[model samples]
Target chain A: MSEIIRLTTPLKDEDIVKLKVGDNVLISGVIYTARDAAHKRMIEALEKGEPLPFDVKGQIIYYVGPSPARPGRSIGAAGPTTSYRMNPYAPKLIALGLKGMIGKGKMSDEVKEYCQKYKAIYFGAVGGAGALLAERIKSAEVIAYEDLGPEAVRKLVVEDFPAIVVYDTHGGDLEEMGKLQYRE
Target chain B: MRVVDVSEITEAVAKLCIDANYNLPEDVYEALKRALDEEKSPVGKSVLKMIIENADLAREGVAPICQDCGLGVVFIEIGQDVHLVGGSLKEAIFEGVRRGYREGYLRKSTCHPFTRANVGDNTPPVIHYDIVPGDKIRIVVAPKGGGSENMSMVTMLKPADGLQGVIETVVKRVDEAGGNPCPPIIVGVGVGGTFERSAFLAKKALLRHVGKPNPDMELAKIEKIMLERINKLGIGPMGWGGTVTALAVHFEMEPVHIASLPVAININCHAARHKEIVI
Candidate 1:
């Protein structure tokens, strides 16, 4: 197995290009959270020339809607949601210099094209491993659309949050690569 | 006739909802362990390991297994000789769901289809009722996640399509879904009956133990064949790609009108959770 890569948020162009599909990554520092509802709102804000909840440049957005945190814990069962639901707005976000996205499932062709062209990367979290994944989140607070409840946009501090580089700037795809390697 | 209080029903439903979401069913937990042992890719094995560990943590912490705690799906088998009292059965079930989501810290995922507004308390569960011969009530709560539910479908094929058509359609559905539904998924297929009944069967089939064959020999054989074909797709664990894309393919068939051959496929993520109780 190849050595795992460690990264911090607000990823640089160098960080993205050095990665390949199937590479294990441990991402620390700050990452933003959003899902279908928040994504739509973010794009609408962009279209109206309104400021976004957070600056898009050099940031990572995790596609997750975590359960309500218990009394003392920072979060609860926080796993990545399926990524395809964000297809409509992903390209727009990528073009705006969003450096990384964390979610499960495949990206659309257009999303992938934007990732390659704009130097962004797509990372896959172990889908459905919510409770275990929640352990890595140091803190979380809703930054925008708090009324959206679980679908609200949150800013999170994560440490060694596990992910796999599913799509990279060089047009690599782990889903296809892994299949080719193991398919009967 | 045996008298059953609606309060008992409500309490049981509430507990089942919380239990199903917080604890992974033993059958599914074991299947993940077996998948971990058998998966070839290093990443796939790791993914499986994490899923197994997540279940353990959720149970120990008394937290939700997945944030998408799912719209509460209640399957009730009511005995013909039992008398229900104290309240409306449907209302009781909804109350149970509301209390469970609030008390259990489960996500309230139900919403207005077009408005996208959440129902807030996860009320008005998707309930299915069956009348049975005994004088008892059997309640099963299966929280249905949106990700996997989105990947499910129902189709009406001509009689000429037969078994081959069903298998091909199911395989194609999973292939197209890829990792969207979450790999190492349990595929529940409901064939024959009318369109809606087939869809109902598809969802109901998921309540079966993971990978256990249908009692009917013919369907069991078909399930084995379809499972073999699906895993060959190499969707692997969480679609990271490997040999264990699906842990099981469960097929349930019923008689249908000669003119219709309806089939529905309901995919459940590896969390494949459902808990039951009897009263």
Candidate 2:
């Protein structure tokens, strides 16, 4: 059984140290959004020894490209996209002090290993619960890659953002947990 | 031949786009409700609850069920005896999609596959048309999200490969998909058609009400067996541990040449947004 962890703003490596697969986390803080295209640019900037657009240390990145917001709304129905697409870029970010990732789907072996080595957690948000999830985001502003449209990077203030730990620093996985329970 | 004006078709298509995006189909809603009851894990149950609540919120005008309203996918069935008047049928459908996405506050998700550039306003929907027997037009709008579409696969196997081959391929695909397509998914399998046709049938099969069996007893039996095996994979709702990995499996089959057997599997996440209108 996994424990529920309450996380606040300015997440730290120590805050995620005890997190294991199958844990439930209710996060309250600011998180940045980046999908496939944005991730590429961030990593490319890092590789060139150039300064990143935003400080990634102790930060969590959500993989999402939301719909256009309606009138008076800060953001549209915002839900996590598949994480596997970010597998190639995730470990690189983790090495740069990134503490967590929020999305749906399993990570690559390298990503899992990086989490175990670097004290990062992989959080799974309800895949289609965009509208409900968006309700948690108090505000949002485009931060980088404006030309990428929905794929641009954005800074968001969220409250009680719900997620489950799919992968943890301890190398555990919820996918394995379920498979064990259901395996005949 | 009867003539149907493009403007009328546009109105029908527009309504379909909005309704399909906003409301969860009754059959799909029932399936999710049933899954919530059957789900064993606390986490799985909670996830299911949130999904149900999301649907309710969307219906109540609180929010959309999902943010990715998806590129408009329209399937049109025109009666052979009827002619479209005033303008191109395709253009009118595109206009409807544009208006619906704008008025409904649904996202415009279409982009260039390689360049990844957005086509503003979500125009030029993917329209599939077929001529049928009636003098009336039938339109179905299914907004397929990216997560589920990413998990879809198409495989071509030898005729000698048979049923077992089909089963193994599907299982492999689902296993590989893991939590990506979102668990408690609905699996749609298309068998025996040509390559493209098989893919089409797989997507079309998703239109069936969840947990409802195919009319063909043999295919229905296959669906049941596949459903049992897939759930047994332990990929529960949202890929968390539970007994309700997939709410249902739907299959559509067509005759193929003796030398070839093609299979395609299209997965739909819990949302499964779709609606239909006829005129």
Runs of candidate 2 with Cα error greater than 4 angstroms are A1-3
In model 1, the clashing pairs are none
User: With candidate 1 superimposed using the best TM-score fit, by how many Å does residue A2's alpha carbon deviate from the native?
Assistant: 2.2
Off by over 4 Å in 1: none
For candidate 2, list the clashing residue pairs, or say none. Answer: none
lDDT of 1 at B3: 96
- Tell me the docking grade of candidate 1: high
DockQ of every model listed? Answer: 0.80, 0.73
The B-chain TM-score of model 1 reads 0.98
TM-score of 1: 0.99
Q: How well docked is model 2, in DockQ terms?
A: 0.73
When just chain B is superposed on the true chain B, each candidate scores a TM-score of 0.98, 0.98
Question: Residue by residue across A69-132, what tens digits does model 2's lDDT show?
Answer: 8788898889899999999999999998888999988889999999999888899999888878
Clashes of each: 0, 0
- Highest TM-score: give the candidate number: 1
State each model's C-alpha RMSD to the native. Answer: 0.9, 1.4
- lDDT for model 1 comes to 0.92
